[model samples]
Target: MKALWVVGDIHGAYDKVRALLLRAGLIDFGGQWTGGDAHLVFLGDYVDRGPNGVGVIRLIRGLEGQARSAGGQVSALLGNHEVMFLAALVFKQGDPHDRLGFREYWLENGGQPRDADQIEPAELGWLAERPAMLRVGDWLLVHADSMVYLKMGGTIDDVNASVRAVLAHANPDDWGCS
Candidate 1:
């Protein structure tokens, strides 16, 4: 059986994340994936809070390719922070009636300036395209412990589809509903 690992709510704690992975023997001193053929799943919140959100993203993105080349798999789920960040980027000007705009909301919620400043288009696209939920064997993985996903759909595939659709439109209401 292939080794399986799951990590969640990184919240920009790059050092802590690195230490944890190192302790788990998943990565080496050089921060390279050493777990050949292992399946790793990140449960999101890769950005915001602490510092080095961009660094964390860079690490994960790199690890994804490295893992794949080693016959391993790296999967990331969409978290609320990602949605908020994307919203902030897409609607930086703020809404008419709302006191706080997307950027303000994101900042208030621990958004790191460097992360937003250095965000690449490809990174944004990757975050926006992540699935809201996933299922592996008998395990069902979701970022939040709320019924909000039900608003998307009954099945995992449906929920992912709905989330993709909402993200495609980049409409606040659609994102809010999802």
Candidate 2:
């Protein structure tokens, strides 16, 4: 069997996340991908609630490319927090989905202002493009442990396609869920 690793709710804390990966033998001190072809799955919430959210993002984004080049896979799923982050970035206010206002919504939901300010265009795109769920062998990999995915679609591809559509829309009102 292949080496499979699952990580959940980073919530910033780059040093801690890095330490976890390091201890897992997935990365080295220099922050290079050392896991060979092992697959690593990050179950979202990569931002908010802690310091160094942007640093955590950079590390994961960097690792995505490195892992791919090394014939490994890095599956970073989208949690509700990421949805809030994207919504906060694109819309300043007046989102029907967020009565508190998009920016305010994010803040109330553990968003870090510094992290929001430091986000790059590429990073935003990367975050938005993340899958909501995935499957590895018998593992039904999803960020949220909820039945909401069942309403999204019948299969993994169907669910992803549905989420991609939701994410692709310019207006926040079009997003049925956040």
TM-score, candidate 1, is 0.92
**TM-scores of all candidate predictions against the true structure:** 0.92, 0.92
The global C-alpha lDDT for each of the candidates, from Candidate 1 onward, is 0.84, 0.87
Q: Which candidate wins on lDDT?
A: 2
Spell out the clash pairs found in candidate 1.
Answer: none
Cα RMSD to native, each candidate?
1.8, 1.9
C-alpha lDDT of candidate 2 relative to the true structure: 0.87
Clash count, candidate 1: 0
lDDT by residue for model 1 over 109-164, one digit each (tens)? Answer: 99887898998999898888898888877788889887777777889999999888
lDDT of 1: 0.84
Candidate 1 Cα outliers beyond 4 Å, as residue runs:
94-100
Give candidate 2 regions above 4 Å deviation: 94-100
Cα lDDT tens digits for candidate 2, 3-60? 9999999999899999999999999999999998999999999999999888988999
